[model samples]
Target: MNPFLIPRRPWTRQCMLPLGARPGLGTAAGNWQRLQEAAGGLPVPGPATLGNQPRLSGDAACCRVTPRLDRPKPLVFSAMWVWALLPILLVLWGTVGFWLVYAMAVANGSVNVTVVFPYISTCGSDPPQSCIFGQVMNVGSFLVVWISYLRFQQVRDWGCPCALNTAGLVLGLLCALGASVVANFQQNNQLETHLFGVFLAFVVGIVYFWVQAALTQQVKPRHGGGWLGPARFCLCATGTALLVAMCALHGLGLKSEAAICEWALTQSLFLLFGLFAEDFRHIESCCVRLQGRAPSPALELGAASTQTLAL
Candidate 1:
Protein backbone atom coordinates (compact mmCIF):
# COMPACT_ATOMS: atom_id res chain seq x y z
CA MET A 1 0.00 0.00 0.00
CA ASN A 2 1.13 3.59 -0.68
CA PRO A 3 2.26 5.28 2.54
CA PHE A 4 0.56 8.65 1.96
CA LEU A 5 -2.47 8.13 -0.30
CA ILE A 6 -4.37 5.43 1.56
CA PRO A 7 -7.72 6.52 2.99
CA ARG A 8 -7.96 6.44 6.76
CA ARG A 9 -10.59 6.63 9.49
CA PRO A 10 -11.25 9.98 11.15
CA TRP A 11 -9.27 9.32 14.34
CA THR A 12 -6.03 8.17 12.66
CA ARG A 13 -2.67 9.88 13.41
CA GLN A 14 -1.46 9.73 9.79
CA CYS A 15 -2.54 12.44 7.35
CA MET A 16 -4.06 11.26 4.09
CA LEU A 17 -3.10 12.78 0.73
CA PRO A 18 -5.15 13.03 -2.51
CA LEU A 19 -5.52 9.89 -4.62
CA GLY A 20 -3.14 9.30 -7.65
CA ALA A 21 -0.72 11.98 -6.38
CA ARG A 22 2.60 10.39 -5.47
CA PRO A 23 5.39 12.16 -3.59
CA GLY A 24 9.14 11.63 -4.25
CA LEU A 25 9.89 10.82 -0.59
CA GLY A 26 7.76 10.14 2.51
CA THR A 27 8.72 13.48 4.06
CA ALA A 28 6.52 16.38 5.16
CA ALA A 29 8.04 18.72 2.54
CA GLY A 30 7.68 16.15 -0.20
CA ASN A 31 3.99 15.51 0.61
CA TRP A 32 3.36 19.27 0.60
CA GLN A 33 4.71 19.56 -2.96
CA ARG A 34 2.65 16.65 -4.25
CA LEU A 35 -0.49 18.16 -2.67
CA GLN A 36 0.22 21.46 -4.43
CA GLU A 37 0.58 19.72 -7.81
CA ALA A 38 -2.65 17.80 -7.19
CA ALA A 39 -4.31 21.19 -6.77
CA GLY A 40 -2.91 22.26 -10.17
CA GLY A 41 -0.02 24.55 -9.25
CA LEU A 42 -1.96 26.10 -6.38
CA PRO A 43 0.23 27.52 -3.63
CA VAL A 44 -1.06 25.31 -0.82
CA PRO A 45 0.00 25.99 2.77
CA GLY A 46 3.28 24.35 3.81
CA PRO A 47 3.74 22.03 6.80
CA ALA A 48 5.00 24.95 8.95
CA THR A 49 2.13 27.32 8.13
CA LEU A 50 -0.17 28.29 10.99
CA GLY A 51 -3.80 29.53 11.01
CA ASN A 52 -3.95 29.78 7.20
CA GLN A 53 -7.54 29.77 5.96
CA PRO A 54 -8.39 26.96 3.54
CA ARG A 55 -8.27 28.06 -0.13
CA LEU A 56 -9.99 26.55 -3.16
CA SER A 57 -7.78 26.73 -6.24
CA GLY A 58 -7.72 25.21 -9.79
CA ASP A 59 -8.61 21.54 -10.75
CA ALA A 60 -8.93 19.89 -7.32
CA ALA A 61 -10.45 23.01 -5.72
CA CYS A 62 -12.94 20.88 -3.84
CA CYS A 63 -10.26 19.26 -1.68
CA ARG A 64 -8.64 21.77 0.70
CA VAL A 65 -5.53 20.31 2.31
CA THR A 66 -4.05 22.17 5.32
CA PRO A 67 -0.55 20.81 6.00
CA ARG A 68 0.12 22.75 9.18
CA LEU A 69 1.91 21.24 12.22
CA ASP A 70 -0.71 22.06 14.77
CA ARG A 71 -1.32 19.86 17.78
CA PRO A 72 -3.87 17.14 16.95
CA LYS A 73 -7.01 16.99 19.02
CA PRO A 74 -7.52 13.69 20.77
CA LEU A 75 -10.58 11.62 19.87
CA VAL A 76 -13.14 11.75 22.66
CA PHE A 77 -15.89 9.11 22.80
CA SER A 78 -17.78 9.58 26.08
CA ALA A 79 -19.29 12.51 27.97
CA MET A 80 -18.08 13.71 31.35
CA TRP A 81 -21.08 12.17 33.11
CA VAL A 82 -19.72 8.67 32.37
CA TRP A 83 -17.35 8.93 35.34
CA ALA A 84 -20.26 9.31 37.77
CA LEU A 85 -21.27 5.73 37.07
CA LEU A 86 -18.19 4.35 38.81
CA PRO A 87 -19.36 5.33 42.27
CA ILE A 88 -22.93 4.26 41.56
CA LEU A 89 -21.79 0.84 40.39
CA LEU A 90 -19.62 0.44 43.47
CA VAL A 91 -22.53 1.25 45.79
CA LEU A 92 -24.94 -1.12 44.02
CA TRP A 93 -22.44 -3.95 43.98
CA GLY A 94 -21.75 -3.61 47.71
CA THR A 95 -25.36 -3.17 48.84
CA VAL A 96 -26.67 -6.03 46.74
CA GLY A 97 -23.82 -8.33 47.70
CA PHE A 98 -24.27 -7.76 51.41
CA TRP A 99 -28.01 -8.36 51.37
CA LEU A 100 -27.77 -11.30 49.00
CA VAL A 101 -25.31 -13.04 51.23
CA TYR A 102 -27.49 -12.42 54.28
CA ALA A 103 -30.57 -13.75 52.53
CA MET A 104 -28.77 -16.85 51.34
CA ALA A 105 -27.41 -17.54 54.83
CA VAL A 106 -30.85 -17.12 56.33
CA ALA A 107 -32.40 -19.52 53.80
CA ASN A 108 -29.75 -22.19 54.41
CA GLY A 109 -30.14 -22.03 58.21
CA SER A 110 -26.50 -20.88 58.44
CA VAL A 111 -27.75 -17.75 60.21
CA ASN A 112 -30.93 -17.16 62.17
CA VAL A 113 -32.87 -14.12 60.99
CA THR A 114 -34.47 -13.40 64.38
CA VAL A 115 -32.11 -14.89 67.00
CA VAL A 116 -28.68 -13.83 65.71
CA PHE A 117 -27.69 -10.31 64.61
CA PRO A 118 -24.82 -11.12 62.24
CA TYR A 119 -22.01 -9.00 60.91
CA ILE A 120 -21.44 -8.72 57.16
CA SER A 121 -18.56 -11.18 57.53
CA THR A 122 -20.76 -13.61 59.47
CA CYS A 123 -23.30 -13.65 56.65
CA GLY A 124 -20.60 -14.61 54.17
CA SER A 125 -18.68 -17.10 56.29
CA ASP A 126 -20.68 -20.10 55.07
CA PRO A 127 -20.58 -21.99 51.76
CA PRO A 128 -22.50 -20.74 48.71
CA GLN A 129 -22.83 -17.10 49.79
CA SER A 130 -19.15 -17.07 50.74
CA CYS A 131 -18.20 -17.59 47.09
CA ILE A 132 -20.42 -14.75 45.89
CA PHE A 133 -19.26 -12.50 48.70
CA GLY A 134 -15.60 -13.06 47.84
CA GLN A 135 -16.14 -12.24 44.17
CA VAL A 136 -18.18 -9.12 44.98
CA MET A 137 -15.60 -7.80 47.45
CA ASN A 138 -12.67 -8.47 45.11
CA VAL A 139 -14.38 -6.57 42.29
CA GLY A 140 -15.40 -3.77 44.68
CA SER A 141 -11.79 -3.43 45.89
CA PHE A 142 -10.56 -3.00 42.31
CA LEU A 143 -13.18 -0.28 41.75
CA VAL A 144 -12.16 1.38 45.02
CA VAL A 145 -8.54 1.53 43.88
CA TRP A 146 -9.57 3.16 40.60
CA ILE A 147 -11.80 5.69 42.40
CA SER A 148 -9.00 6.50 44.85
CA TYR A 149 -6.57 7.36 42.07
CA LEU A 150 -9.14 9.45 40.24
CA ARG A 151 -9.96 11.37 43.43
CA PHE A 152 -6.26 11.96 43.98
CA GLN A 153 -5.90 13.35 40.47
CA GLN A 154 -8.98 15.53 40.86
CA VAL A 155 -7.63 17.10 44.06
CA ARG A 156 -4.19 17.68 42.54
CA ASP A 157 -5.74 19.26 39.50
CA TRP A 158 -7.66 21.62 41.76
CA GLY A 159 -4.29 22.97 43.11
CA CYS A 160 -4.54 21.32 46.52
CA PRO A 161 -1.56 18.98 46.84
CA CYS A 162 -1.05 18.86 50.57
CA ALA A 163 -0.17 15.89 52.79
CA LEU A 164 -3.87 15.21 53.40
CA ASN A 165 -4.44 14.40 49.72
CA THR A 166 -1.62 11.87 49.71
CA ALA A 167 -2.76 10.45 53.01
CA GLY A 168 -6.31 10.00 51.66
CA LEU A 169 -5.03 8.07 48.65
CA VAL A 170 -2.82 5.82 50.80
CA LEU A 171 -5.62 5.16 53.27
CA GLY A 172 -8.08 4.40 50.47
CA LEU A 173 -5.68 1.81 49.09
CA LEU A 174 -5.17 0.28 52.55
CA CYS A 175 -8.93 0.04 53.01
CA ALA A 176 -9.23 -1.75 49.69
CA LEU A 177 -6.45 -4.17 50.64
CA GLY A 178 -8.24 -4.87 53.90
CA ALA A 179 -11.51 -5.56 52.08
CA SER A 180 -9.69 -8.05 49.86
CA VAL A 181 -8.11 -9.78 52.84
CA VAL A 182 -11.46 -10.06 54.58
CA ALA A 183 -12.97 -11.49 51.40
CA ASN A 184 -10.41 -14.25 50.97
CA PHE A 185 -9.90 -15.12 54.65
CA GLN A 186 -13.26 -15.93 56.19
CA GLN A 187 -13.82 -14.92 59.81
CA ASN A 188 -14.81 -18.47 60.72
CA ASN A 189 -11.64 -20.00 59.25
CA GLN A 190 -9.04 -17.31 59.94
CA LEU A 191 -10.24 -15.20 62.84
CA GLU A 192 -7.06 -13.23 63.49
CA THR A 193 -6.42 -12.29 59.84
CA HIS A 194 -10.08 -11.45 59.32
CA LEU A 195 -10.06 -9.21 62.37
CA PHE A 196 -7.03 -7.38 61.07
CA GLY A 197 -8.78 -6.86 57.73
CA VAL A 198 -11.89 -5.59 59.50
CA PHE A 199 -9.76 -3.09 61.38
CA LEU A 200 -8.16 -1.87 58.17
CA ALA A 201 -11.39 -1.58 56.22
CA PHE A 202 -13.52 -0.06 58.99
CA VAL A 203 -11.06 1.97 61.07
CA VAL A 204 -8.74 3.13 58.29
CA GLY A 205 -11.67 3.54 55.94
CA ILE A 206 -13.44 6.03 58.27
CA VAL A 207 -10.24 8.05 58.59
CA TYR A 208 -9.91 8.14 54.81
CA PHE A 209 -13.40 9.59 54.53
CA TRP A 210 -12.58 12.27 57.09
CA VAL A 211 -9.45 13.20 55.16
CA GLN A 212 -11.42 13.49 51.92
CA ALA A 213 -14.01 15.72 53.60
CA ALA A 214 -11.27 18.05 54.79
CA LEU A 215 -9.80 18.22 51.31
CA THR A 216 -13.20 18.95 49.81
CA GLN A 217 -13.53 21.94 52.12
CA GLN A 218 -10.02 23.18 51.31
CA VAL A 219 -10.39 22.95 47.53
CA LYS A 220 -13.94 23.88 46.65
CA PRO A 221 -15.05 23.04 43.10
CA ARG A 222 -15.53 25.58 40.32
CA HIS A 223 -19.27 25.80 40.99
CA GLY A 224 -18.59 25.98 44.69
CA GLY A 225 -18.97 23.09 47.15
CA GLY A 226 -22.78 23.35 47.31
CA TRP A 227 -24.28 20.35 49.09
CA LEU A 228 -21.39 17.96 48.36
CA GLY A 229 -19.03 19.42 50.94
CA PRO A 230 -21.55 19.48 53.76
CA ALA A 231 -22.85 16.01 52.83
CA ARG A 232 -19.36 14.56 52.94
CA PHE A 233 -18.70 16.08 56.35
CA CYS A 234 -21.96 14.66 57.64
CA LEU A 235 -21.16 11.17 56.41
CA CYS A 236 -17.69 11.42 57.86
CA ALA A 237 -19.01 12.49 61.25
CA THR A 238 -21.68 9.82 61.30
CA GLY A 239 -19.33 7.05 60.20
CA THR A 240 -16.73 8.01 62.80
CA ALA A 241 -19.23 8.11 65.65
CA LEU A 242 -20.67 4.79 64.58
CA LEU A 243 -17.16 3.26 64.36
CA VAL A 244 -16.25 4.40 67.88
CA ALA A 245 -19.55 3.25 69.29
CA MET A 246 -19.24 -0.13 67.59
CA CYS A 247 -15.82 -0.69 69.11
CA ALA A 248 -17.05 0.17 72.56
CA LEU A 249 -20.14 -1.97 72.21
CA HIS A 250 -18.11 -4.92 70.95
CA GLY A 251 -15.66 -4.58 73.83
CA LEU A 252 -18.58 -4.57 76.23
CA GLY A 253 -19.90 -7.86 74.75
CA LEU A 254 -22.87 -6.13 73.08
CA LYS A 255 -22.66 -8.18 69.90
CA SER A 256 -26.07 -7.22 68.54
CA GLU A 257 -25.53 -3.46 68.85
CA ALA A 258 -22.02 -3.77 67.45
CA ALA A 259 -23.35 -5.71 64.49
CA ILE A 260 -25.95 -3.02 63.79
CA CYS A 261 -23.27 -0.36 64.02
CA GLU A 262 -21.09 -2.24 61.56
CA TRP A 263 -23.93 -2.39 59.03
CA ALA A 264 -24.65 1.34 59.43
CA LEU A 265 -20.99 2.25 59.09
CA THR A 266 -20.72 0.25 55.87
CA GLN A 267 -23.70 2.08 54.40
CA SER A 268 -22.25 5.44 55.40
CA LEU A 269 -19.02 4.64 53.60
CA PHE A 270 -20.95 3.63 50.51
CA LEU A 271 -22.91 6.88 50.56
CA LEU A 272 -19.69 8.85 50.99
CA PHE A 273 -18.16 7.27 47.92
CA GLY A 274 -21.34 7.79 45.92
CA LEU A 275 -21.07 11.52 46.57
CA PHE A 276 -17.98 11.50 44.32
CA ALA A 277 -20.43 11.66 41.43
CA GLU A 278 -20.45 15.45 41.81
CA ASP A 279 -16.67 15.57 41.84
CA PHE A 280 -16.35 13.61 38.56
CA ARG A 281 -19.10 15.49 36.70
CA HIS A 282 -16.66 18.14 35.53
CA ILE A 283 -14.29 15.79 33.69
CA GLU A 284 -14.98 15.48 29.98
CA SER A 285 -12.16 13.46 28.53
CA CYS A 286 -8.90 11.79 29.52
CA CYS A 287 -6.09 11.31 27.00
CA VAL A 288 -2.65 9.71 27.14
CA ARG A 289 -0.02 10.68 24.56
CA LEU A 290 3.44 9.20 24.08
CA GLN A 291 6.43 11.50 24.60
CA GLY A 292 9.27 10.35 22.42
CA ARG A 293 11.94 11.67 20.07
CA ALA A 294 10.99 12.49 16.47
CA PRO A 295 10.58 9.48 14.24
CA SER A 296 13.86 8.12 12.86
CA PRO A 297 14.61 8.80 9.17
CA ALA A 298 13.96 5.15 8.28
CA LEU A 299 10.67 5.08 10.17
CA GLU A 300 9.55 8.32 8.56
CA LEU A 301 10.60 7.17 5.06
CA GLY A 302 8.15 4.32 4.56
CA ALA A 303 9.15 2.17 7.55
CA ALA A 304 5.92 1.45 9.30
CA SER A 305 5.58 2.43 12.97
CA THR A 306 2.39 1.99 14.94
CA GLN A 307 1.37 3.09 18.42
CA THR A 308 -1.78 2.15 20.27
CA LEU A 309 -3.41 4.08 23.10
CA ALA A 310 -5.80 2.58 25.63
CA LEU A 311 -8.27 4.85 27.47
Candidate 2:
Protein backbone atom coordinates (compact mmCIF):
# COMPACT_ATOMS: atom_id res chain seq x y z
CA MET A 1 0.00 0.00 0.00
CA ASN A 2 1.18 3.58 -0.73
CA PRO A 3 2.04 5.47 2.46
CA PHE A 4 0.23 8.65 1.11
CA LEU A 5 -3.04 6.75 0.69
CA ILE A 6 -2.98 5.09 4.10
CA PRO A 7 -5.10 6.72 6.82
CA ARG A 8 -3.55 7.24 10.30
CA ARG A 9 -5.80 5.53 12.79
CA PRO A 10 -5.37 6.47 16.49
CA TRP A 11 -8.98 5.69 17.50
CA THR A 12 -11.52 2.95 17.18
CA ARG A 13 -13.95 2.53 14.22
CA GLN A 14 -16.58 4.82 15.90
CA CYS A 15 -14.76 8.01 14.72
CA MET A 16 -16.56 10.29 12.22
CA LEU A 17 -15.17 10.54 8.69
CA PRO A 18 -15.42 13.36 6.06
CA LEU A 19 -18.51 13.36 3.83
CA GLY A 20 -16.90 11.44 0.94
CA ALA A 21 -14.91 8.76 2.89
CA ARG A 22 -15.86 5.84 5.16
CA PRO A 23 -14.02 4.56 8.28
CA GLY A 24 -12.69 1.07 8.17
CA LEU A 25 -13.67 -1.44 10.88
CA GLY A 26 -13.70 -5.12 11.45
CA THR A 27 -16.84 -5.73 9.45
CA ALA A 28 -18.38 -8.10 6.94
CA ALA A 29 -16.96 -7.30 3.50
CA GLY A 30 -20.44 -6.79 2.03
CA ASN A 31 -21.43 -4.22 4.75
CA TRP A 32 -18.07 -2.42 4.37
CA GLN A 33 -18.54 -2.25 0.62
CA ARG A 34 -22.04 -0.90 1.09
CA LEU A 35 -20.79 1.88 3.42
CA GLN A 36 -17.94 2.81 1.02
CA GLU A 37 -20.39 3.02 -1.84
CA ALA A 38 -22.68 5.33 0.18
CA ALA A 39 -19.75 7.63 1.11
CA GLY A 40 -18.51 7.79 -2.53
CA GLY A 41 -21.90 9.23 -3.61
CA LEU A 42 -21.62 12.22 -1.14
CA PRO A 43 -19.99 15.58 -2.02
CA VAL A 44 -16.22 15.88 -1.36
CA PRO A 45 -14.09 19.00 -0.63
CA GLY A 46 -11.83 19.74 -3.65
CA PRO A 47 -8.17 21.07 -3.73
CA ALA A 48 -9.62 24.58 -2.76
CA THR A 49 -10.06 23.54 0.93
CA LEU A 50 -6.48 22.72 2.20
CA GLY A 51 -5.66 25.92 4.19
CA ASN A 52 -6.93 28.03 1.25
CA GLN A 53 -9.45 30.96 1.53
CA PRO A 54 -11.55 32.99 -0.95
CA ARG A 55 -10.14 36.35 -2.20
CA LEU A 56 -11.64 39.59 -3.66
CA SER A 57 -11.89 39.61 -7.49
CA GLY A 58 -10.30 42.47 -9.47
CA ASP A 59 -13.52 44.50 -9.80
CA ALA A 60 -14.44 43.88 -6.17
CA ALA A 61 -10.97 45.01 -5.01
CA CYS A 62 -11.30 48.29 -6.88
CA CYS A 63 -14.76 49.04 -5.49
CA ARG A 64 -13.80 48.18 -1.92
CA VAL A 65 -10.91 50.72 -1.72
CA THR A 66 -11.44 54.44 -0.90
CA PRO A 67 -9.93 57.18 -3.15
CA ARG A 68 -7.02 59.19 -1.75
CA LEU A 69 -8.31 62.57 -2.96
CA ASP A 70 -11.57 64.54 -2.55
CA ARG A 71 -13.45 66.68 -5.08
CA PRO A 72 -12.82 70.50 -4.96
CA LYS A 73 -15.55 73.08 -4.22
CA PRO A 74 -17.14 74.98 -7.20
CA LEU A 75 -17.22 78.59 -5.96
CA VAL A 76 -13.59 79.50 -6.77
CA PHE A 77 -14.32 80.72 -10.33
CA SER A 78 -17.23 82.93 -9.25
CA ALA A 79 -15.12 84.56 -6.55
CA MET A 80 -12.35 85.36 -9.07
CA TRP A 81 -14.85 86.97 -11.46
CA VAL A 82 -16.05 89.29 -8.70
CA TRP A 83 -12.46 90.15 -7.76
CA ALA A 84 -11.77 91.19 -11.37
CA LEU A 85 -14.58 93.79 -11.44
CA LEU A 86 -13.54 95.58 -8.25
CA PRO A 87 -10.96 97.87 -9.91
CA ILE A 88 -13.48 99.06 -12.50
CA LEU A 89 -16.00 100.01 -9.82
CA LEU A 90 -13.39 101.96 -7.85
CA VAL A 91 -12.28 103.92 -10.95
CA LEU A 92 -15.88 104.86 -11.83
CA TRP A 93 -16.59 106.07 -8.31
CA GLY A 94 -13.48 108.23 -8.20
CA THR A 95 -14.11 109.77 -11.64
CA VAL A 96 -17.74 110.61 -10.92
CA GLY A 97 -17.12 112.00 -7.44
CA PHE A 98 -14.28 114.20 -8.66
CA TRP A 99 -16.39 115.66 -11.49
CA LEU A 100 -19.41 116.47 -9.32
CA VAL A 101 -17.34 118.28 -6.71
CA TYR A 102 -15.33 120.12 -9.37
CA ALA A 103 -18.48 121.28 -11.11
CA MET A 104 -19.84 122.58 -7.82
CA ALA A 105 -16.60 124.50 -7.18
CA VAL A 106 -16.70 126.01 -10.65
CA ALA A 107 -20.33 127.09 -10.20
CA ASN A 108 -19.57 128.70 -6.84
CA GLY A 109 -16.62 130.75 -8.23
CA SER A 110 -14.35 128.79 -5.92
CA VAL A 111 -12.30 127.53 -8.86
CA ASN A 112 -10.28 129.93 -11.06
CA VAL A 113 -6.77 130.26 -12.46
CA THR A 114 -6.14 133.33 -10.27
CA VAL A 115 -7.40 131.58 -7.15
CA VAL A 116 -5.79 128.19 -7.96
CA PHE A 117 -2.61 128.80 -5.96
CA PRO A 118 -4.22 130.66 -3.06
CA TYR A 119 -6.99 128.09 -2.90
CA ILE A 120 -4.48 125.30 -2.54
CA SER A 121 -2.16 127.18 -0.16
CA THR A 122 -4.85 128.65 2.09
CA CYS A 123 -7.12 125.60 1.80
CA GLY A 124 -6.84 125.07 5.56
CA SER A 125 -8.42 128.48 6.26
CA ASP A 126 -11.43 127.76 4.07
CA PRO A 127 -14.24 125.54 5.28
CA PRO A 128 -13.02 121.97 5.78
CA GLN A 129 -15.66 120.93 3.24
CA SER A 130 -13.79 122.44 0.26
CA CYS A 131 -10.37 121.26 1.43
CA ILE A 132 -11.60 117.77 2.16
CA PHE A 133 -13.37 117.49 -1.17
CA GLY A 134 -10.29 118.56 -3.10
CA GLN A 135 -7.98 116.22 -1.20
CA VAL A 136 -10.41 113.31 -1.56
CA MET A 137 -10.75 113.85 -5.29
CA ASN A 138 -6.99 114.05 -5.78
CA VAL A 139 -6.27 111.01 -3.64
CA GLY A 140 -9.16 109.05 -5.14
CA SER A 141 -8.00 109.68 -8.69
CA PHE A 142 -4.49 108.52 -7.83
CA LEU A 143 -5.79 105.38 -6.12
CA VAL A 144 -8.12 104.51 -9.00
CA VAL A 145 -5.42 104.89 -11.64
CA TRP A 146 -3.04 102.75 -9.61
CA ILE A 147 -5.68 100.06 -9.18
CA SER A 148 -6.52 100.15 -12.88
CA TYR A 149 -2.86 99.70 -13.81
CA LEU A 150 -2.54 96.79 -11.41
CA ARG A 151 -5.68 95.18 -12.85
CA PHE A 152 -4.33 95.50 -16.37
CA GLN A 153 -1.09 93.91 -15.22
CA GLN A 154 -3.00 90.94 -13.80
CA VAL A 155 -5.15 90.54 -16.93
CA ARG A 156 -2.17 90.39 -19.26
CA ASP A 157 -0.13 88.22 -16.90
CA TRP A 158 2.91 89.80 -18.51
CA GLY A 159 5.82 92.09 -17.78
CA CYS A 160 5.37 95.86 -17.97
CA PRO A 161 5.30 96.81 -21.63
CA CYS A 162 6.30 100.47 -21.61
CA ALA A 163 7.62 103.15 -19.29
CA LEU A 164 5.20 105.64 -20.81
CA ASN A 165 2.41 104.67 -18.45
CA THR A 166 4.62 105.05 -15.42
CA ALA A 167 5.95 108.32 -16.74
CA GLY A 168 2.45 109.65 -17.33
CA LEU A 169 1.29 108.78 -13.85
CA VAL A 170 4.37 110.29 -12.28
CA LEU A 171 4.00 113.42 -14.41
CA GLY A 172 0.44 113.80 -13.23
CA LEU A 173 1.61 113.75 -9.63
CA LEU A 174 4.33 116.24 -10.51
CA CYS A 175 1.79 118.56 -12.09
CA ALA A 176 0.01 118.68 -8.77
CA LEU A 177 3.30 119.38 -7.08
CA GLY A 178 4.02 122.17 -9.56
CA ALA A 179 0.68 123.75 -8.76
CA SER A 180 1.58 123.69 -5.08
CA VAL A 181 4.91 125.35 -5.78
CA VAL A 182 3.27 128.08 -7.85
CA ALA A 183 0.81 128.76 -5.02
CA ASN A 184 3.57 129.12 -2.41
CA PHE A 185 5.75 131.46 -4.50
CA GLN A 186 6.54 134.56 -2.36
CA GLN A 187 5.60 136.94 -5.17
CA ASN A 188 1.78 136.79 -5.42
CA ASN A 189 1.66 137.62 -9.11
CA GLN A 190 -1.59 135.79 -9.91
CA LEU A 191 -0.81 135.86 -13.63
CA GLU A 192 2.52 134.11 -13.25
CA THR A 193 1.02 131.49 -10.93
CA HIS A 194 -1.91 130.97 -13.30
CA LEU A 195 0.44 130.52 -16.23
CA PHE A 196 2.37 127.88 -14.31
CA GLY A 197 -0.87 126.09 -13.53
CA VAL A 198 -1.71 126.08 -17.23
CA PHE A 199 1.73 124.70 -18.04
CA LEU A 200 1.23 121.96 -15.47
CA ALA A 201 -2.18 121.19 -16.97
CA PHE A 202 -0.58 120.72 -20.39
CA VAL A 203 1.95 118.37 -18.85
CA VAL A 204 -0.97 116.44 -17.41
CA GLY A 205 -2.35 116.09 -20.95
CA ILE A 206 0.87 114.54 -22.20
CA VAL A 207 0.71 112.15 -19.27
CA TYR A 208 -2.83 111.18 -20.27
CA PHE A 209 -1.71 110.18 -23.74
CA TRP A 210 1.08 107.99 -22.38
CA VAL A 211 -1.21 106.39 -19.82
CA GLN A 212 -3.87 105.82 -22.48
CA ALA A 213 -1.37 104.17 -24.81
CA ALA A 214 -0.30 101.77 -22.08
CA LEU A 215 -3.88 101.06 -21.09
CA THR A 216 -4.97 100.44 -24.68
CA GLN A 217 -2.47 97.61 -24.95
CA GLN A 218 -3.90 96.08 -21.80
CA VAL A 219 -7.62 96.52 -22.68
CA LYS A 220 -9.88 95.63 -25.62
CA PRO A 221 -11.79 98.05 -27.82
CA ARG A 222 -15.55 98.63 -28.12
CA HIS A 223 -17.56 96.99 -30.91
CA GLY A 224 -19.66 98.45 -33.72
CA GLY A 225 -22.56 100.80 -32.90
CA GLY A 226 -21.30 101.22 -29.36
CA TRP A 227 -21.20 104.85 -28.22
CA LEU A 228 -18.42 104.26 -25.66
CA GLY A 229 -15.58 104.40 -28.18
CA PRO A 230 -16.83 107.52 -29.92
CA ALA A 231 -17.72 109.11 -26.60
CA ARG A 232 -14.19 108.60 -25.28
CA PHE A 233 -12.65 110.04 -28.41
CA CYS A 234 -14.98 113.03 -28.34
CA LEU A 235 -14.36 113.70 -24.66
CA CYS A 236 -10.59 113.64 -25.04
CA ALA A 237 -10.71 115.76 -28.17
CA THR A 238 -13.03 118.31 -26.60
CA GLY A 239 -10.90 118.49 -23.51
CA THR A 240 -7.80 119.07 -25.58
CA ALA A 241 -9.50 121.75 -27.64
CA LEU A 242 -10.83 123.47 -24.54
CA LEU A 243 -7.44 123.48 -22.92
CA VAL A 244 -5.91 125.04 -26.02
CA ALA A 245 -8.68 127.62 -26.14
CA MET A 246 -8.20 128.49 -22.48
CA CYS A 247 -4.44 128.92 -22.99
CA ALA A 248 -4.98 130.99 -26.12
CA LEU A 249 -7.54 133.21 -24.36
CA HIS A 250 -5.20 133.72 -21.46
CA GLY A 251 -2.31 134.61 -23.77
CA LEU A 252 -4.46 136.94 -25.91
CA GLY A 253 -5.98 138.58 -22.78
CA LEU A 254 -9.50 137.50 -23.74
CA LYS A 255 -12.55 138.07 -21.49
CA SER A 256 -12.99 135.97 -18.32
CA GLU A 257 -16.28 134.50 -19.58
CA ALA A 258 -14.58 132.66 -22.47
CA ALA A 259 -11.90 131.22 -20.21
CA ILE A 260 -14.48 130.09 -17.67
CA CYS A 261 -16.59 128.41 -20.33
CA GLU A 262 -13.60 126.66 -21.87
CA TRP A 263 -12.41 125.49 -18.47
CA ALA A 264 -15.84 124.06 -17.61
CA LEU A 265 -16.02 122.21 -20.92
CA THR A 266 -12.52 120.81 -20.44
CA GLN A 267 -13.33 119.56 -16.97
CA SER A 268 -16.50 117.88 -18.17
CA LEU A 269 -14.68 116.16 -21.01
CA PHE A 270 -11.85 114.99 -18.75
CA LEU A 271 -14.30 113.47 -16.29
CA LEU A 272 -16.25 111.66 -18.99
CA PHE A 273 -13.15 110.42 -20.79
CA GLY A 274 -11.53 108.99 -17.67
CA LEU A 275 -14.72 107.31 -16.49
CA PHE A 276 -15.47 105.46 -19.76
CA ALA A 277 -12.08 104.62 -21.32
CA GLU A 278 -11.70 101.12 -19.85
CA ASP A 279 -15.25 99.99 -20.57
CA PHE A 280 -15.11 101.40 -24.10
CA ARG A 281 -11.88 99.57 -24.83
CA HIS A 282 -13.22 96.25 -23.49
CA ILE A 283 -16.43 96.41 -25.54
CA GLU A 284 -14.68 97.50 -28.72
CA SER A 285 -12.15 94.67 -28.60
CA CYS A 286 -14.80 92.02 -27.98
CA CYS A 287 -16.77 93.24 -31.02
CA VAL A 288 -13.76 93.28 -33.32
CA ARG A 289 -12.49 89.87 -32.30
CA LEU A 290 -15.97 88.32 -32.66
CA GLN A 291 -16.35 89.45 -36.29
CA GLY A 292 -15.45 85.92 -37.56
CA ARG A 293 -13.16 87.41 -40.21
CA ALA A 294 -10.09 89.58 -40.00
CA PRO A 295 -10.80 93.24 -39.39
CA SER A 296 -11.08 95.34 -42.56
CA PRO A 297 -7.83 96.44 -44.21
CA ALA A 298 -8.65 100.04 -43.35
CA LEU A 299 -9.14 99.10 -39.70
CA GLU A 300 -6.00 97.00 -39.52
CA LEU A 301 -3.71 99.63 -38.01
CA GLY A 302 -1.38 97.25 -36.18
CA ALA A 303 -2.36 97.27 -32.47
CA ALA A 304 -4.70 100.13 -33.36
CA SER A 305 -7.32 97.55 -34.42
CA THR A 306 -7.58 96.55 -30.78
CA GLN A 307 -7.05 100.08 -29.32
CA THR A 308 -4.08 98.66 -27.43
CA LEU A 309 -1.64 100.82 -29.37
CA ALA A 310 -3.58 104.07 -29.07
CA LEU A 311 -3.57 104.27 -25.28
lDDT of 1 by residue, 93-119 (tens): 999999999899999989885885988
- Residues 1-311, model 2: lDDT tens digits: 10111112221222222332322322223333443443344322322232232332221110111123343333322233343354455446545654555556555665565634222223222343345444554554454455445434433433444465556456656554543433333123355665575456455744564465445444443222355445556666666676667667757766464446454653553454355334433321211122256577677665333422110
Error of 2 at 126 (Å): 5.0
Q: Which ten residues in a row have the lowest lDDT in candidate 1?
A: 55-64
- TM-score, one value per model: 0.71, 0.41
Model 1 misplacement above 4 A: 1-78, 220-225, 290-311
Question: On a 0 to 1 TM-score scale, where does candidate 2 land against the true structure?
Answer: 0.41
State each candidate's clash count: 0, 11
- What's the true lDDT of residue 38 in model 1? 53
